[model samples]
Target: MTTESIDTAAEIEAIHAVVAAVQKAQRAEDADAFLALFHPDAIWTTGGGKFLNGRDEISEFTRAVLPGATKDGYATYEPFFVRFIRPDVAAVKVRQQYFNHADELQSQGSPLYGMTKEDGRWLLTFCQNTPVVDH
Candidate 1:
């Protein structure tokens, strides 16, 4: 493999690490810690297409979502598409599959997240979670 390929792989891995850390913070219901995974001016959107811009809005959204998620039971974030747009930008597409204690996929949600490396750290700049709705 070429050096560029290796670096791309490593960068994608780093983005995964950021997602993992955010998941950890979410499971713990730690808003402060969760916010640490995002940029201060991060833009977030929900399945309903509601945008929460800036730190305050994002913080509130995290506070509301995390607790409910923890209560309903947290699902593992399985990353599907981990691709690099450029050396400094990357995106991760993850599936949040709701599971029971035995790990069954009760329901599922897909979240597309865009991240950027700034000052030697990878942080989420944008994210949108779209849950699969059943009628």
Candidate 2:
């Protein structure tokens, strides 16, 4: 493989790891772990349409909701696509599914996460969680 291909592979792997951390944090209800994956100036918009600006706001929102968000059901985030805009920036499309304790499907979400590589670490810089609605 060429150097470019190798670099791309490594970058994709790093981004995937970041996405996996999100799933792990959410599933385990580890607010601190979840928040640590984001940049200090990150922005997040919930599936319900609430806009959270910056890490402070994200931290507050996540800490308040995440712990109980999965009490009845657990959430899983799977990245289906990753587009690199620059060597240090990437846009990742994720499919999020919620399952009840019995493993029944609860809801689905399509979230787009913008991540940036800083100090060799990939951190989420922006995210928009959109609910999948069926008419």
Candidate 3:
């Protein structure tokens, strides 16, 4: 494998880990764990059309929103594409599908996350969830 391929693979893996953290936190309804995946100055936009910036706002948003998902029944997520804009910056587009405790489908949407590497570890910088529109 070439140097470029190795770097890409590593970046992708890092992105995957970040997404996994988000999913795990959501499923478990743990705000602290979910916030751990983001930078101190991270910004978030929700499917309900709201913008939250900084760690405190991020925490508030997570605590308030995640429980709703849990109450409504949410499960895991799958990142459809992780695009490396540069060696230290990447974008991941994912579908966070929710299922009831009984494993019945609930809701799903594409959540786009932008992240950057600081001190060799990826931290989410921005996130937005695009609601699924039915025609």
Ranking by lDDT: 2, 3, 1
Model 3, 5-33: lDDT tens digits are 44787778888988888888888888888
Q: What lDDT tens digits, residue by residue, belong to model 2 across residues 1-135?
A: 123433888888889899899999998889999999999999999988999999999999998888676779888888999888777888899999989999999889999999999999999998999999988
- Which should have the higher TM-score, number 2 or number 3? 2
Better of 1 and 3 by lDDT: 3
lDDT comparison, 2 vs 3, better candidate: 2
Candidate number achieving the greatest TM-score relative to the actual structure? 2
For model 3, state the Cα shift of residue 92 in Å.
Answer: 0.5
Please give each candidate's TM-score: 0.85, 0.93, 0.89
Instruction: Judge candidate 3 at residue 43 and give its lDDT.
Output: 90
Candidate 1 vs candidate 2: the TM-score winner is: 2
Q: Note the Cα lDDT for every prediction shown.
A: 0.81, 0.90, 0.83
RMSD of each: 3.0, 2.6, 2.7
